[model samples]
Target: MCSYGSKLVAPWTIASPISAKICRLRQVAKRFYNFGSKEYKSAFGDAPFFDSQGLRERTIQYIKNFDASIWHKDPIRTIVKGNYFIQGVESDTTNAIGNINGKQIFADKETFEKITAHISSSALRYEVSKCKDLMKAVRRLEADLL
Candidate 1:
């Protein structure tokens, strides 16, 4: 165990199981996302803003053509609406957005468009607009998804 000033200095250095797991997770995520890589720069940029080729147009068209009635019967609409209630409201990052999976929601143009097409703005307003905590999340998601 590496130590300094009476405290362990390398808990994640394969000595502590818990620390090693956490550190390994971070390593895998950082390597997979390559968040600082120039390849990431070729993507939609650091933020979730739709800055890709023809992506912004597709998102807009999807939102504009999205049918709000789709929320009335489908069980999944509830899921996306639930996401709006907490997404950006709790923080700048989220694990999901509507039917959008946070893990790969932005992976490709098709998935991104599908997510935008499924989001229910009215249901979101009904559920989240009244709550201060959720409104921020709603706003952020709306801006990105819409």
Candidate 2:
């Protein structure tokens, strides 16, 4: 087994010139912070290859997204005044008619959860079956994992 500090470097000194060049390329790639699809580890590696800074940004964003306002109160059962406001195209006609119950009514958290729960699983199945080929690789399989 290789040690942490000298593992890759120690191998580089002993490796052939071609191997050394490959390792050097990997070293440069390891330093990259690109949040793009070109990311890899070994030649045919997986997606979601987060470097140190990318991981840190995601960690901070997770903490920043925590709802402090919800800490004191229970989950909402009815629509609040704040929930009534939906941000969309801002126009005089839209302002007068769209908000404050035009055709559809905004539900509170509890109601929204209940309504979604009824349709969620079926709706997801419908969506997946619609484009089965495109989503085949990532979508969950019926077979057990080895």
lDDT of each: 0.50, 0.46
For model 1, the stretches where C-alpha displacement exceeds 4 angstroms are 1-15, 43-67, 71-146
Report the number of the highest-lDDT candidate. Answer: 1
lDDT of 2: 0.46
Candidate 1, position 18, lDDT: 77
Give me the displacement of residue 11 in model 2, in angstroms: 39
For each candidate in turn, the TM-score is 0.24, 0.20
The positional error of residue 32 in candidate 2, measured at the CA in angstroms, is 33
C-alpha-based local distance difference test score of model 1: 0.50
Report clashes for each candidate as comma-separated counts: 3, 0
Give the per-residue lDDT digits (tens) of candidate 2, residues 92-140: 2123556422222245566567546644553455335454253343333
Count backbone overlaps in model 2: 0
RMSD of 1: 18.7
TM-score of 2: 0.20
The list of candidate 2 runs beyond 4 A from truth reads: 1-45, 61-66, 71-146
